[model samples]
Structure formats: C-alpha cells, structure tokens
Target: MSFLQRLTTGLTASKIGTDRFGNTYYESRKSWLGYGRKRRFVLYAGEPDPTTVPPEWHCWLHHVTDAPLSEQKRYPWQREHQRNLTGTAQAYRPPGHDYAGARRAPTAGDYEAWTPGG
Candidate 1:
C-alpha cells in the first residue's frame, strides 16, 4: 500500500480474519470519511485483485457472513478462484477470433450448396 492509502484507511480497523490467499480482512466502527456504520477493508497480500477473493471470504468482506472464511466448509463442487485476464495472453480466445488462432477451425461434415433447391 502507498503511504497515502495507509494514512487514509484501515489504520484504526480491528483485525477480523486472514484468508488462505494471504489477504487480511479488517473491520472498523470508527468514522472513516464521515461514515457512521461499520466498514470492511482488506490488506491485500499482493496487488489488490478482487477476483482473488474466494467465495467464503467474499461473503464476510461484504457483511454477508457472520463468520470468517475459515469457519466455513467448502463443498467439493466449488472451484478455485481465478483473476480476470481480459487483455493478457492467458485470456480466453475462441477459434474464430481475429487476434489469435486460425479463423473457425473447420467445423464440417457432408455439406451441400443448394442452387434454388432445384
């Protein structure tokens, strides 16, 4: 965090929890920027990426959970979180895409071109 962001936020907050991703969560009842209600904040372990937050921790971060992520049980169906990669090389590219691979990788069987259905 920059010196200015630390000075402006999360200084007075109480440590609530830390996720497996190393992001530390906090809560502050103190008035920040003149807000009265409690506030939530995260001290990111690395660059601040919201998608890195898993489903369990996300709930607590948004006041949707009474308990932290550690207290929750993750079902087997839940997949790991993935950060957004819209512009990166790892981003999704369809076969017909112009920026990447061959345009429309041959989707065909026996095809017939009709001339007025004669």
Candidate 2:
C-alpha cells in the first residue's frame, strides 16, 4: 500500500456515520496524545475543509452533544448549516461594487486651476 494509506490505516475506525454531502466521520479506536486520554478526531473523506462540516457534526466534534444526529431530536426552528465564504468571489457585491464601471460623483467645491511656473 501507499505511505499515506499506511499511515491512515493505523487509525482504525468503523463506519460510524456520514452526512448528506457524503462526508464520512470515523471514531478513532485509538487515543490521541493529549490530556483527555481517550480523544477522538474526525476524517473528511471528501473535501477536507472544516467549513464542510455540518452543524450537527460540528456540535459533536466540539463535545457539545453526546449523541449523534441520527439518535438526536432536531427542532423545527433549527436552520441548515452553511459555510461562511465572505470576502471571496462567491460573495455578493451590491449595485456599485467598488469602482469598476462606476462614475465618481461631482463634488460641490471643484476648482482645479494651478499653474506650476506662473
């Protein structure tokens, strides 16, 4: 097997759960080198970005909820989790949108008559 695959193989975890977007989470059978002694870390099979983690899993990952989403009760007012991609090209740029293709407004006191040599 490949070196990367061999390294990951050490962390053996059964198929604990998966998200709608096909992000599978594994519960590490081994303990991480930390104070907790029995700490767990998640592995994203697809996009390995933290923003891709859903709210339900986010809470569990942070130890907010002891039970997984499959065994938990969701409230009606609960909103779907969305990754914040502000300041990026995906973000919306209202009407003016900086200075591109926009004309500057005329100022009230506009007088430009300066002779360098005179």
Candidate 3:
C-alpha cells in the first residue's frame, strides 16, 4: 500500500485468510476511519479482480452463505463454479465457428439482379 492510502485508511497489520494468484484478503481489527471502532474489511492484496474469488468464497464475502466451504458439504451432483470469460478470446470455439473453420455457401439466384441500364 502507498503511504497516502495507509495514512488515510489507518490500517494496521491484519489477519490473512488465504492467498492465491497474487490475491490476498485480510481482516483488520482496527477501524478504517480510525474512529476507535473496529470493522472487518477485506482488502485485495493485489489487483481487485472479482474472478480471483471462487464461488464459495465469493458467497462468504458477500454474506450470502453463513458457513465457509470448510464447514459446508457439497452435493454429489453439484458442479464446481467456473468463471465466465465468454465473448473474450479465451472463450470456447465450437467446431462450426464461422470465423474459425465454417465456410459460407454461394448466394442462390432466386431473384434477378437489378441493372439500371438493362
């Protein structure tokens, strides 16, 4: 963190839960505003990419789930949550992708072409 951010947020050493792919979140026991009251704040150690968080962790972070993954059980049919990166270059390209390998058929002569002089 920069000197200005540290000074403005008044953050002290925090308890780290996990660190993955340069993303680390910490819980502070000190108030961010330094008003003598402590509030839990999750800070992204690196870039603030929402995809960095897994589904279970995302639910916990948003308070949607009361229990963490460690305390929870997964159903047999439940599939793991995967980040949606569609519309990007990394998206899935099926066999008939028009830009990749699909060929366009020649135009049919259903209607005569219009000619100004004819």
When 1 and 3 are scored with lDDT, the better candidate is 1
What is the per-residue lDDT of model 3 for residues 1-118, given as tens digits with 9 covering 90 to 100? Answer: 6788666445454544553444444445555575544443355556555676755466666556544355247699986545566887778877658755784444686567899999
TM-scores for all predictions: 0.69, 0.55, 0.43
Q: Which pairs clash inside model 2?
A: none
Task: Judging by lDDT against the true structure, name the best candidate.
Answer: 1
Give the winner by lDDT: 1 or 2. 1
Which runs of model 2 end up more than 4 angstroms from their true locations? 1-3, 6-11, 71-84, 99-118
| Candidate 2 lDDT score at position 40 | 43
> What RMSD does each model have against the real structure?
4.6, 5.9, 6.7
TM for candidate 1 is 0.69
Q: Which ten residues in a row have the lowest lDDT in candidate 3?
A: 19-28
> Residue pairs in steric clash, candidate 1?
none
Ranking by lDDT: 1, 2, 3
Q: What is the C-alpha lDDT of each candidate?
A: 0.77, 0.64, 0.56
Which of the predicted structures, 1 or 3, would earn the higher TM-score when compared with the native? Answer: 1
Candidates arranged by TM-score, highest first: 1, 2, 3
Residue pairs in collision within model 3 = none
